[model samples]
Target: MKKTIQRPVVPPASVSTPVVSPIYPSVVYASDDPDGLDAQYEGGAAGYTYAREGHPNADLLARRIDALEGCSGGIVLGSGMAAVAAVLLGLCGAGDHVVGGNQLYGRSLRLMAEDLPRLGIATTLADPTDMAAVEAALRPETRLVLIEVVSNPTLRVADIEGIARLCRDRGVLLAVDNTFTTPLAVRPFALGADIVLHSVTKLLAGHSDVTLGWVAARDPDLAVRMRVFAVTTGMTPSPFDCWLAERGLATFALRFDAAQRNAAALADWLAGQAGVRRVLYPTRADHPDHNRAAALLGGQGCNMVSFEVAGGRKAANALARAADGVAFAPTLGDVGTTLSHAASSSHRALSPEARAAIGITEGFFRVSVGLEPLDALKTTFAAGLAAARDA
Candidate 1:
């Protein structure tokens, strides 16, 4: 396997991009070019013509993520779904097949189950942790193998490098949703992933205020196709959202560090509690993919910690309500700690059997650790646990 380091390209003098405004955290503008040129120069030819087709903010953000992912280039999308849809629709057409991870985001599962089929694309769901299962699920018509860097809700880290090798050998595209573990925690491209996607709404944005997404690839051709699909489908992020994500990127390294530390501490504490039926974190020795996660992801686990309560849905609901100061929100990755009942919030669309197969139980709750003081978060969890035990 060959690895390439991609450096950011400086836009030519004629392309005058905007300076991010200090007051508006989420908006930026491209000022008029000093040369009075309306287009970008790419070897004496125009590359970026319009905002929808291409914008300075989008390109800058893309380059930053490319650097983070160690990829050739990247495409920023309107949302995470747009990024996934662009990759799937751009890479595959009628009669093509897709092998997807069984434990995926609800919307992604819906896209695979309902939407892709409508376009004549067939899909097979497999346990990504099982290399043999993923390999066996591949077919001649399979155009892409889709997975998440870390499974949503479950927090199971996939064997990304192995899966990438499998895709390369099969002559298929490998795409990973790197939302849960942002590039700060894991670089999917370096792990052999052909394409890496992000729902900038989560850890990437750091704050819970923005909704944006991006897709990066080591292959220039793949990047071009995704850009074309994005422009044709009008799935570009607002200049405002792009600016917000960029601002978020500046603090990403710091925030993720603190959040992950808190998450690990919380996971360790939860494991010993009498009411905790299970604790799932990649760094945990008992995690199913602990070794693979350690080998591929290094020592830093993601900020998410998921666990099961002893009393099923009733206890889980009680725990959520019992937490003081922590917001019992369905979303994750904020400056303040947040919790969600996955069985009802993220996995609600799945059937009971499907949810069970994916390790999403009625007692499961996902906690996204934030930068809050560790003691405060621990106190909140302790209170929640005590309530759950009483329930």
Candidate 2:
């Protein structure tokens, strides 16, 4: 027999807890007995019963996000659209009215203006910045007031506290899409919003990989109801996705800060470019709603920059082709700088009249500034703008 070297015994205190949470991917958890099963069915303080109802990973993500939004509780969903559908279907029905922003994401506009109407829910679209228009559009049957903190692509800012007051006076629910500005920037609950929505596919997840979203309710009763709606609708996020989202959220502070800084630099530089006609950035002094944004977002907007090319669609196309270092991706919130033609991508579903009404021109494009260095970004954009001007 070969002699084996004796190994030294490890110390008892050598082990430590993992910094990351483990993914619980079971569809159904084990039950100890009939009484245990009954307790779980009746909502006891036990483990998850079904993945559709909830899982350990999903619960962990939900609690973390809820704390971020200052919400009493929240639910995680498969995607942002699913979350939107759950909220609308859960809250409104036939004969109910929804007052919404005209400059909404194309899918959001389509859902509220088209799908909701077919379901017998009336929708009135108005400019969120125009408080008077918002108030005038409200009806006695209006049960929901939906708006984005900063309008997508255009970067227009709305007054959250003022809108909340408007909804409160009418006893309507105020649900804000806080995807653009994360919790680090502003807390909707602190501003009096009743429900807060976020598409984690964008800034919250901080990576393009996760396609999850969330709905946070400031009231615990609403939270419970929303969770039921989430479960019944079968829009729950997958275990793996929830785990990835949680990991993404851990580095959100670092990613968000760097991206926002890059965006600010790009917005400032683009404002002076000869090829650009108008730049829509909330934090800039020249922005139409700069004061409004300052009051709410503290002159620090998110990572979106929108501008119109001087030469219209032709110039915009040229810029897209000339952009050497950036990519023309359909989505946002990636780690690298990317360009997207808003009128063709996010707002493509809108008609010409509707698009024109919301200032999404043929030449307009939205840039999702990423973590690239300012000097390199400037060089890339300068080339693109030059091509646009010449084209």
Q: Go through the candidates in order and give each one's C-alpha lDDT.
A: 0.85, 0.86
lDDT of 1 by residue, 1-391 (tens): 8999764444467566557632222232342463434434333444545577767677777777778877757888889889999999987899999999989999899999999999999999998988889999999999999999889989887878788899999899999998998887788877788888999888887788877889977788888898888889988777677778888888989899989999999999899988888999999999988998888778888799999988887888789889988998889888889998878887799998999988888888999999998999888899999999899
Worst 10 residues of 2 by lDDT: 6-15
Residue by residue across 37-92, what tens digits does model 2's lDDT show?
89978878576778998888878898889888776568899998877877788888
lDDT over C-alpha atoms for residue 329 of model 2: 81
| Model 1 residue pairs with clashes | none
TM-score of 2: 0.94
- Runs in model 2 deviating more than 4 A are 1-16
The stretch of ten residues in a row with the least summed lDDT in candidate 1 is 22-31
